[model samples]
Target: MVKYADDFKAMVVQEYLRGTIGYKVLAEKHGIKSKNQIVDWVNAYKKFGIEGLFRKRRHEVYSVQFKLDVLSFMKRTGASHAETALHFGLTNPSMIGDWKKKFLEGGAEALDYPKGRPVMSDKAKNVKKNQKPTQQDEMTCEQKLEQENELLRLEVEYLKKLRAFQMDPEGYLEKHKQRYHSNSKKNSD
Candidate 1:
């Protein structure tokens, strides 16, 4: 799956809003792999309020209404799963699918509201205000950790390839050695 930044989505959304480019053209121009992405962004903005379109909220889980509206809009718009995924600022289409199924099964209320974090006492808040992360802060930290893990995994794979080549230094050197030997043989001949 192609992962895109929020700015890219916003840019495509803006271009779309201006009526300058069609979905196909915009997808081609902006490197948007999915045509539904363009449609999703515009439709998402139209479907839900601001939250539906933005990617800044990485910690707080969205309300059930938010998910319902997004899925409902995607269904209404005839956008693909990829577009709906992008619309929700989520990278996973399965999540969109799951929500849609829930909504379908349980009506609009299928998206269940999370049980909120426990309330901290005034003294605890005072201490938390001074130092330490809250549940929300921890959630964001976990998101960051996941993002970093993805980057590290890619980097590790790249490095493993490098190490594989490095481990057989003679394999790389063999090519040059063979070329040199061929040149010397020709010279001698």
Candidate 2:
């Protein structure tokens, strides 16, 4: 699943190791964006040799515990993402960063979240297509009340904002321009 081929990585690593060129020059010559990328490739090459640069055919899934262990190891040892990945035999160091972000935002259970699209078997798809709504799918009294409360709260908030805008459209827009700009930037991206 590697992006760069092993041959290309080897060539870059060898060129860098030759001492005639630095990472920045090599990265620019090869159209790579970051010098850090070359640093990682060279580190991997030095640590694991040519085999480290080879592409993996199959995707590897790490268990939640294994992910937690990797994060903990990094935390304990103060290793960089690339170093931690090499220590753990992980090809992609960015995955460790993602795991750390998810863990920080949602704790260990977030590590258990599935990646990629959900695959439905033929039988399951057929069953889902033919299934009709059942009482079990219906909201309970408390859930119904909660939904109503949420709707009412949103309506009230919308009305208040509408009133403010109606009173002073220019002022309201000026007040909210930053929010609008941020939202537009997100949508554009």
Candidate 3:
């Protein structure tokens, strides 16, 4: 959790790489929490220089092939998560662990970058670009009916819930606890 400066990290890594002192001894000398952290820094420095020692501005997106290659190399060499991450120039070793888990659970497809936003289809994009406001009636019969049905279902659910709350305000509140209730209240209860 401690954030070490880039210069400090480089210095530590250089010291470790010099072969003058062991990780445990260096960690003890520098008052570091774990010797493994020093090992990670040293490996990162060796593979990626000082850049890997600093925190990245944004998350790195890896291709499926790249992920597969990293996993393959790790397996072939019997390397640990930290070692593999260091070799790959990844700042966090946990990322390699996550990739391995995803690969094991769902194969290469699991390594694909998750789409963060919904993209408009080509037709929709053209419509928007042309500044043509399409009417709801222009939708296919099936699509119009589906949208109406969904709206009706939502309204009915809302009314039923509202009626229940009106009929039994105390009981409704008692049944549904506030998710963000104060910790002091929880402790007292």
Off by over 4 Å in 1: 49-51, 61-94, 98-189
Please give the range of 10 consecutive residues that has the lowest summed lDDT in model 2. Answer: 180-189
Among these predictions, the greatest TM-score belongs to 2
Per-prediction RMSD in angstroms? 22.6, 15.6, 18.9
Against the true structure, whose lDDT is highest?
A: 2
Query: What is the TM-score of each predicted model, taking all chains together?
Result: 0.37, 0.61, 0.51
Local accuracy of candidate 3 as per-residue lDDT tens digits, 1-189: 688888888899989888999999999999999998898887777766788788776645665545665665566557898876665556777778888898678655566756375568999888778785567538888897996676566445545655665677567545533521232133223
**What does candidate 2's lDDT look like per residue over 121-142, in tens digits?**
9998999899998988899999
Q: lDDT values of the candidates?
A: 0.60, 0.75, 0.69
Error of 2 at 79 (Å): 1.2
TM-score of 2: 0.61
Q: Indicate whether candidate 2 or candidate 3 has the larger TM-score.
A: 2
Residue 100 lDDT in candidate 3: 83
Q: What number of clashing residue pairs does each candidate have, in the order they appear?
A: 0, 0, 0
TM-score (C-alpha, index-matched) for candidate 1:
0.37
